[model samples]
Target chain A: TTQEDPHWATPLSSFQGFEMIKILNDHPKNKSVFVHGKFRGHEEEAVVILEKTPFSEETLPFALSGETKLKVGLKNDIYGNYHGTPPAQVNGIKVSVVYPATPKHLVKYSQQQTYLVQETGDDYRNITLPFLQAEAFRIQWVYNILEHKQESERIVFEDPDKETGFILLPDMKWDLKQVNDLYLIAIVHKHGIKSLRDLTAEHLPLLHNILKKGQEAIQEKFSIPPCKLRIYLHYQPSYYHLHVHFTHLNFDAPGTGVERAHLLSDVIEHLEIMPDYYSKKTLAFCLRENDQLLAEFRKAGRVPQKSE
Target chain B: TTQEDPHWATPLSSFQGFEMIKILNDHPKNKSVFVHGKFRGHEEEAVVILEKTPFSEETLPFALSGETKLKVGLKNDIYGNYHGTPPAQVNGIKVSVVYPATPKHLVKYSQQQTYLVQETGDDYRNITLPFLQAEAFRIQWVYNILEHKQESERIVFEDPDKETGFILLPDMKWDLKQVNDLYLIAIVHKHGIKSLRDLTAEHLPLLHNILKKGQEAIQEKFSIPPCKLRIYLHYQPSYYHLHVHFTHLNFDAPGTGVERAHLLSDVIEHLEIMPDYYSKKTLAFCLRENDQLLAEFRKAGRVPQKSE
Candidate 1:
C-alpha cells in the first residue's frame, strides 16, 4: 500500500508502545508518505508500514477529531477518509501545529469573512474578529477581556493587507436592507451620493450621457424613460460613508419582492462591474428592475406611508 | 414681582375648591390654563392668572427620574440671570425638560435619544426631540439607550419647517477628521474585485471626470475651494459602502481635528447642493481634497501590503 502511494511519508518511531496513534499534517492528506523504522545512523525511528484504510469512522488505530485546521499542503489529502483512533491517554493533551486555515482566515477574499487579523503581538494569540461578524464564530465570551472603561475607545487591529489593521470595534448600525426592498435599496446605497439633488446634478446627467454613448457603442440596446426612476436619499449613520438609497416603489404588487430583490442585486452587481462604462442595455435593465422593485415595496407597504 | 407682569392672564375664580384640574389645548405650556380654586364654575377662571413668574426651580417641581423626560426652557429674567424652567407638566407633575449635550461616544452628528411611553396602545404619549441646531431644550440619557439594543429605531417629532418630522436614529459612525492629513482608508471585506481594478476600470474614470470638472468650475469662479470639502467612494463585506474620506488639513492645526471633520461633514451634508453648478474653486478644492485623502490612505497603508 505504501509503495502504491508515492506521496506517503514515513511515520516517527515515537509511535512505539502506543496502542493508538494519530498523525496530522497541514498539507493535503493524499501527499503524505509514511515509512517505518529509523533511517541509517538514526537512533530514533518507527518501524511499521502504513496502509490505506477504507472507512473513516472505524478500523484506524486512532480516531480523528475532525477539528483539524487547514494550512499549506492541506489540499493534497483533503479527499481521503481516514478516522484516527488515538488512545484515550491523549485526551487532555494539547498539540499545536500550523494549519492552512490559519492563513486563510488571516488574509483571504470572501464575502463570508468580514476582517482578518494575523498574530502580531505576543499578548493576544487568537484571531481578531469585528463585533458584527464575531457572532458567526460563536465567541460570546469576548466581553470579559476588556480592562479600560471609556465608552469611546476604538479597537484597531493591524491588517497586514491594508497598511493599518484598524482594530474591530462593536457598533450598532441600522441595516437598511432590513427595512424595505433590500436589493433595490442596496443598489442605491452602493452609490455614495444621496438625495435627488445630487443624483440629477451629478449621477443622472453623467449616467444619461454614458448610457446614451454606451448605447450607441453596443449592438443591442433598449430605450429607457429617465423620469420613471425616483430616488430617496438616506444617510447611513452606522456607515462612515454617506450614501443615497434610490427608491422606486410601485404602489401595486405588479411584481414579487423575492424576484425583484434577486434581479436588483444582479443589476446592481452588473452596474458595479462596469460603473464607468455602463452599456445602454445595462441601464435599461436596471431601470426595468428598479421599476419592478418600487412596485413591490409599495405593495408590501414597506415604504413609509404619508398622510395626504 | 409676579403681580406686575403685563403678560399675565388672570385665572378664573369659579372652581376654587376643586382638587383636580384638567386643561387641554394645542399650545405647549399654554395648552391648558388652570388655577387652584375652591369653587367650580365659569367664574373660577378669573382667579387663574397666567402670571409668568421668574421661572426657576420653584416654578417647576419635578425629579429627573427613570423615564421622566422634560424640555428645559430658560429665559433671562428681570435679574439678568438665565433662569431655566420646565415647559410643561404631565400627570400634574412638573418634569425637567433638557436636551443632553452631544454624546461623547459619537464623533459627529451621531446621538441616541429615548422617549418614555407610559402606555402601549394608541393612547401611548411620546414627545420626540428633533435633531437640529442647538435648542434651549435638550434630552439627557441618549447614548446609554442605544448601547443596550444594537439596532436602529427613531422617534419622529413634528417639525414646522419640513412637511414631516425628521427621522433621527442613533448613528455610530466614524469621522474622517480624526485621522491625520484628513485622509481615511477602509478595508472592504467583500469577495472578488480585489486591488483598484474594480474601482479604476469601472468607477474611477467617470468619477474622476466629475471631480475634475467640479474642481475646474470651482477654480474658474470663486478662485477658492467650497467651504469645507469632503469626498467618498464605496469599496464591500466589512463595509457595504467601502469609501475614502478626504479633507483640507492645510489651514488648520495639526491635531485640532475640528476643521477636517467639519469639512467632511459639510460635504456630506451638502452633497446635493447646486449639483449642476459647482464653482471652479469648489471643484478644485474637492479634487485636491480627494487626491490628498487617497494619497494619505495609500501612505497609511490602506492597500494590501504584499504586492502580488
Candidate 2:
C-alpha cells in the first residue's frame, strides 16, 4: 500500500484502533511510556508520544485564566534529585502543554544520529571549504536583526564596536522565562568573519567580550551567574553569520552536542596558544544523513554515496 | 511512604497491576509506546522498562535453541532510510534480544544526566587537580591485561615500546561480534598519564601511533574503514589508566557525548600548536548529580552543596 507520505511508517488509523492489552515498556525521558495491546486481533504495539507540548500565544492566555483547570507538582530531574537553590530550597521545574506535535519534537525525543567526522587538515581544505563556499544559506532574518530592521526591540545587550562588539538577545525559541531553559544568542558585529574556521588569535578579543558580557548581561537581568551558563558555538552553523549560544548549563538545547558544540572558552584558549590554530587544525563533526554538506562530501568521494 | 530504598519511587507491584485503559501516548526511541490506561480506578500510568536483557552463560544456549520462537525482519533506522552499504544495501543493524533488564538499563535509557563542567585553568589547578590526586580509583584489571596475566587471549594488537607502546583489544562489554557495535580499547603502556590533563606535545608520537595502528588493526580484522570508525577518549575516564577507544560510527555506545568525548585528532592538534595546551585550557564536563566529583566540588565550595 504505497501512500502519499512515507513518514507515517504505520498508519494513523491503526494506532487509533489499537486496544490496550498490558504494560509493555516505558521510560521517563520526554515522558515516553509504552503499553502492549492488540490491534484488529493481531498482537500489535502502538506508539503514542506523550509529550508536554510547548505554549503558544493562543494557549498562554487561556492557561493563565481562571477558567482552565490546573495541577501543580514539583518537577524532579531524572535522577530523582531536585535542583534547588540553597537558601530558598526552590526547585526549577517546567509545566505547560500545547497541541499537535511537529517533526522537530519527534527528532528531538528520538535517538540522536550524531557521529564523529574527524578530518585531516587537507580534508578540510578539499571537502568542507568547497562546500561552505558553494552553499547559499538564506540568512536574511539575521541581516534584518543586525540591520535593526526586525527583532531590534528584543536586544538584551549590544556593543556598537565593529571589531569586538556583538548584539545579545533571548533566542526566539525561549519562552522568556529566566528560570526555565534560559537561552540567548550573541551575533558578532564583525562582517566577513564566518564560522569557527575564520576565528584566529585576532578574534580572541571578540570571543572573550562575548563570553564575559553575555554572561554579565544575563546575570544582571536574570541573576544567573557565569559558572551556571554553558556557552558555545556551532560549526557548520545553521547560517553563515557568526553567533555564540549561551544556554543554562542544565538546558539540553539543540546543537549543544559534542559533534557540533565548540566551547567559547576552548576556542579562546586554542587561539591564545596558537594564533593560526583554527587555520591549521583539522576540524571534525557529524553530518546528518540529510545534510547538504554530506551530499557535497559524497559528490567529492570523501563520503561514500548513499546506496539504493 | 518511604521504603527501605528510596530509589524505587513507586512500588514495583503497582506497575504490574496497572491496567491499560486507552491508547494515550508513546514513542520509539527506547520503544516507549504508551497507552491511555488505568490501574484499579486510580488513573495510574505505569512505567515498564522493556529492555533487551544481556545474554548470560545460562541464557545464551537457551535463546539459540531451535525450540524457541524466532522473528526476523529488516531493521530500519529512525530516519526511515536504510543505513545500507552501497551496492549491497545490507544496512548495519542489530537483531539480538534478551529479557529482565537491570537498573542501569533504566538509567541508561533514561535522559542523560550529562552537564558541561567547564573549568578555567585556575579552577583545574585549585579544584580538579586536587580531586584527582586525592581520589583512589581501583584498576587492577588494567594491570592484569597489560601484564599478560588475564584476558591476554583477546589482545588484538600490541606494541611493546615502553614509551609509546600500547595494547589494543576488544572491550570486555563487547559480545565478540565484529559487525554489531565493534568496541575496542587501547591502553597506553607508559604510566603516570592519568587523564587528558597529562597529555602534552611530547606525547604526540604516542597519540599518533595509537591513531594509525588502532585504525589499521580494526580495518584489517573487521574490514571497517578508518572513516567509518569513531575514535575518542574521555577526559575524566572511568579509570585512571591512559587509554583510547575505537568504535563503529553507527554505534551510539555510551560516552560518545561532547561533554566527555575529545577526539584524538583534536587533542593532537591542540598539542601540536601548544605543548602545554591541556594544562592551560579551561576544561568542562557534566557531573551527574550523584557523582563523587560533584560532591567534592560541593565540599570545596566550587559548587554549592545541596539544600534540605
Candidate 3:
C-alpha cells in the first residue's frame, strides 16, 4: 500500500526483470500497475503487472500458472527496479541469474538453419545471375575479407604497393603429399577484376611483376628451383577471385588441363595483343551437376541442359 | 682353263658365292670376271669371276687380301652354280653358312634411329600443317594399321559395318592402378572424319549408336557402372587420328580439359543443331614449345610465338 517505498516491490534478477520489461514495453498501450499473486509452484506471494491491470484473486492463478514463484518474483522485482540501480543481493541471499540450458536438438537445428541461409545466399550470388553480376558480389566479398584482415594467417607475401599479394593455402585435393605440395594463390589486389577474362593489356606490367616476384618468393621459401614450378589459372575457377595457382611442375593438379589451365605467361601475352581478347573469346569450362553457374548457362541457352 | 668341269671351281658354300656375286652385281658397270686370291689369314686359295676378267696367280694376293679362302671359294662356287642348283654339302662339312653377328653398338644405334624416325614422322603429321592437311597422313597410317591388324591384341570390338571400332590401351600416364584403368579408343573408321570438327548432322546417328554400344560394352567388360565412365575427345589431339577416349570418371587423364575434351554427346547435339558448327567455330588449344602446330599458328598470326 506504501507505493513511495523503494522496497515495496519484490526483488528480482536483472535478466528476468528485463525480459518482463521487454514484454510490457512491446505493448505500448498498457500503463504500469500492480498485480498480486502466488507464483505457480511456490507458497510465496508476489506482484506483477500487465499494463495497468492488477491481478485479482480470480486472475492470480492464470497470471502465475506456468512459471515458478522464484521466476515470477525475480521478473516482477527486476521490472520494478528498472529505473534504478538493482540490488546486488536479494533477501540477504546471493542473487544469481542462471539461463536455462538449450536443448541439443535446438542447438543443432539453429546452427543448420544458419548454414543453410549462408549456402543459399552463396547460390543466389553464384548461379542465378550472369557471370558479370555474380562476379560483383564475389569481388566485394573478397575485398571485404582482405580489408578486415580475415585471412591474415594465410597471407604469405604482400607487396608494398598493395597491388599484389600471395597466400599459401592448401587445395582441397592435393596432387601430391610431399612437403612441397602447396598451392600459392597469387592475387592481384586491384578490385573488380574477377578472373583471367577480366585481364587486359593494362595489367601486363602487374602480371609480369607478380609472376616474377611470386616465383622468387616460392623458390626462396620452398627451396624449389623455377624449373620445378608450374603456374596457371582456371578459366572457370572454383570461385570468382582473380588468382593464379602455383604448384610443383610434377604435380598433376586437378584443373591443370590445357583446356582449363591458361598459363600465366600465355595469358599475359594474349592480353598484350588484344586487350579484350578473353572478353571476345568463347571460353569453355566444366561444371558439376550442382553448380549454380551451369544452371545459369543452361537458362541462357549457352549450353545444353542435358549433361554428358 | 678347266671351266667345263663342275669341280674345277672351288666347291664354295653357295651363301659365300652369292655374297661375291651380289657385290659384283651392285657394280653393274663391272662385267663378269674371274679373280683368284688366298684367304686373308688362311692358306687356302680360290677363284672369283667378274664378267670376262680372268684371275691369275700374280693378282691372287691382292684380289682376296681381305677375305678367307673359304669365303672366296663359296662366293665363286655359288656364282658359278647360279644357273643350276648347287650341291647342299660342300667340302664334306655340310656347306653350313655362318653369318657374322651384328655389333651391339650397331643394333642399339639402329633401334634409336627407327624410334627417331617414327617420332619425327608423328611430329610432321600433328604439327607441321593445318589440322585438315595433317589428318590426311593420319588417315593413311590408321588405314595401314587396320589393314595389317597392327594392334590386333588391343582390339576389343569391331563393328561389321567397319565404320566403328574400339581398342583398349593404356594411357601414357594412368590415374589409377586398377585392371580397368584403360583408355578405350573409339574410332570412326570413316577415313576423312578427323575429329569432332568434321562431324556433321549426317553422322549423328552413327555417333549416338557408337556411344550407347560403347558404354554397354565398357560396363560388361569392366563391370563398372555407367556412372563411373567419362568419355570425351581432344580437338587438336596429341595425334591427328580421330578417336574418343573413355576412362573412369575418377581418372583425370591428360587432355580432358575444357579446351581439349569435347563430350561425345555434346558433339552429337552440336552437330544436330548446326551440321558444321565445329567447322565454323574457332577452336582453342594449347601447344607446348616444341609443338609444330603452335609454330604454324604463330606464323599465321593466329597465336603469339610465346611459350608458357
Candidate 4:
C-alpha cells in the first residue's frame, strides 16, 4: 500500500508476474531464493468524497483487503543447476527449521504445528510449503519489501510471481520486519563530559575499540565466540542509535511470553553488569544521532566520526 | 499488620488510635496547630505480596475489603484556618482540620449561595456547605493531612468528662517523623573519593559535613524538600537501611479531577521549572550519590593495625 494515498491503496499482480523470478532462473547467482507479489483494491477516490472519518480517523483503516502469493525458488548457483533446484517435498513445512524466530523448544514445536502449511501442486513434485502462518507471513513479506532497496537480481522473493502479488525479496537471510527495536544503553565515563558533545568528540571511537576488544576477549575467554552475533549500528529518532545491537539476528523472539520479558530484564542487567569503571568508559561510545551528526560536522574529513 | 500473620488480620483500631500521636498537653517545648493519626493497615503488605506473584499464575487476586485508608494524616493549616484564626472552642481538643482524601474540588458547588452554621460541637466551622453534596468529599481529608504536615500537631484526644481521643489546641505545630533508618540524598563536591566507601570512612565528622552540605543543597533547591527519605541500602534478610528517598507531597486543587493521575506529572514539571543551570545541577546532585559512594572507596582509607 502506498502511504501517500488517502486509502493507502495496494496493487495486485500474479506470482509469475514479477521480475525477480527471471533472475532466479540464471544459475550463476550465489543467492538461494526469490519471492514477489502485489496487492490491490482500495477506495482512495471514495475516501476523498467522505468526511475523512472513514479513513483518516484511525491509525489503520477500519476496512481493507488484498490477496497476494509469494513464489520462492532457489538460484541456479545454489543448486549447481541452470534451471530451478529440485523442490524439497514436505508434508508440512516445519516452522522451527525455517523461521527459528524463538528460542523455546515448545514454542518452536507449537509454531511448527500451527503456522506451517504444505501446498500441493498438480504433480505434487513442485509443491510449495511455507514456514509462517498465512496472515503473519503476508505481513512479514510486505514489511520486508518496504524496508529493502529494490533490486532485480536478489535471492529473496522479489517483484511478482505466479503465486503471490507485487512485492520484493529481502536481502537478509532472516526476516528483519519481525524485529523489535533493540536498544543498547551505555553508561559513560571519563569524567567532566556528561553531555552528548563529550561523547562523539572523544568517547565513541574509544568505546568501539573497547567493544571490539570485549568481543575478542569473549572469544579468547570463552573459546567459543558466536558465529553470527548479528551486531548492527542502528540510527533512530530519539536515541540517535549510537549503540550496537547484539542478538542471534536483528529480531527478538516473540511468543516466548514470560521468557521474552525475562530476557529483556537479563539483557538490561548484563549491559550494566560490567565493572563500574569499564561500564562507564564503554557506554560513552554510544551517542544520540543528533549529537553524532553535530560531531561528524565538527570532525569532518579528519577522521571517522564515531557515534558517541 | 504483621507479615507473618497467616490469618491476614486487620487492626481493629481506627486511625485515631495509633500510638505515635502526642497530646497537646504533652508538648510544652513547641507550640503550633497540628494533629496526627496512623493506620498500620495491610494495604502496603497486600500490594507487595501481589506484586511478587509468579508470572504464569494466569489470574490476579482481587483486593479484599479494609485495603483502602492506609495513609497517615496531619491537620490542614491553610483551609482550616480559612477564617484567619482558630475558634475558641478548639482549645485542648485533639482537633485536626482534615480535608477528605478524595480528589480536590470533586465537591459540588453553588453559584450564589452562602450559608453560616454557628460553631458549637461541630468539628469544622463555616465549611463550604456545598461540599457535603459531593460524593468525593468523603475522602478529601487525606490530601489535606499530607499537604500541611508542618502546620499540624500530633495530639491525642482526652477528656475528664468523657474519656476519648486527644484534643487539638489552637496553637501547635508538628514535624514529620524522624526514623533512624531514613537518610537524605546528599551531593558534596569536596569529597576526595568517588564511591560509596568514602562515606564509611573513620572520620565521622567529615562524613557528617558531606551529608550536611548535601542536605543544604537539597533544601536550597526546593521549597519543601522531604525531611526523611527512607532507604533500603541492602535488600534481603539482613537488610541495611541506608537508602535515601526524596519526599513528595501533593496537594489537590480545584482542577484536580477524581483520577488525580496528573499529580506526578505536575510535580515533575514544577521541579523542572526552576532556573536551568540550578535545576540541572540539583538533578546532578541527586544522581551523583552513587558515583560519590564509589569514589570514596577508590581512595582507600588508612587500615587500622592488627591488635598486638
Candidate number achieving the greatest lDDT relative to the actual structure: 2
B1-308: candidate 1 lDDT, tens digit per residue: 16773221222112123332222111112211222222333332111111111112221122111122212122121101111111222111111100111222111112111111111111111111111112222222222222322222322111112211112221122111122122322222222322221232233333343344433443343232422223333211112222233322221221121101212222222223223211111110111112222233334443212221
Q: Under the 3 Å rule for N, CA and C atoms, how many clashes does model 4 have? A: 73
Q: Write the per-residue lDDT of candidate 4 for residues A1-308, one digit (tens) a residue.
A: 35674321221111111121111111111111111111124211110000000011111111110111112222121111011111111000000011111222122122110101111121111211111111132222223323443222332222232211222222222222221211222212222332221233234343444345434533453332322223333211122212223333212212111101112222222233322211122110112223322333234332233322
Candidate 2 lDDT (Cα, 0 to 1) = 0.60
What's the C-alpha lDDT at position A137 in model 3? 48
Give the TM-scores of the predictions, in the order they appear.
0.16, 0.62, 0.39, 0.16
Question: Candidate 1 — number of clashing residue pairs?
Answer: 99
Please give the C-alpha DockQ score of model 3. Answer: 0.01
**Model 1 DockQ class:** incorrect
Q: A1-308 in candidate 3: lDDT tens per residue?
A: 26773331322322112211111111111111222233233343332222212223342222212211111101110010001111111101111111221233223222110000111223334443355574454455466545645666656666645555444444445533463466667766666566776677887877888778887887676666554566778866766777788876544456775435766765775576558666545444445555566556567554444532
What DockQ does each prediction reach against the true complex?
A: 0.01, 0.08, 0.01, 0.01
| Residue lDDT tens for model 2, A1-308 | 35763343432211323344433233334332333333445432332322122222223223222232212122232212111111111111121111122343233333433335655567778877877777654566677778887668788999889999999988744646333367899999887777888888888888999998998999898877776678889876777889998887656565665667888888888788778777767777776655656766777777665532
Predicted candidate 2 versus true structure: per-residue lDDT over B96-196, tens digit per residue: 11112244433444442333566666777888778887876778889999999998999999998989999999987798755658999999998888888
Model 2 per-residue lDDT at B290: 72
Better of 3 and 4 by TM-score: 3
lDDT of 4 by residue, B278-300 (tens): 11111100001123222222233
Best by DockQ: 2
Q: Score candidate 4 by lDDT.
A: 0.21
Candidate 4: list runs displaced more than 4 Å. Answer: A1-199, A202-308, B1-308
lDDT of 1 by residue, A1-308 (tens): 26763211232212223221122111111111122222244333222222111212131112112221111111011011111222222111111111112324222211110111111112111211122234343222222212223322432211222211111222223133332222122211122332121222224433333223322322121121211122222211122222222322211112221111112222233244334322211110011113333233334443322221
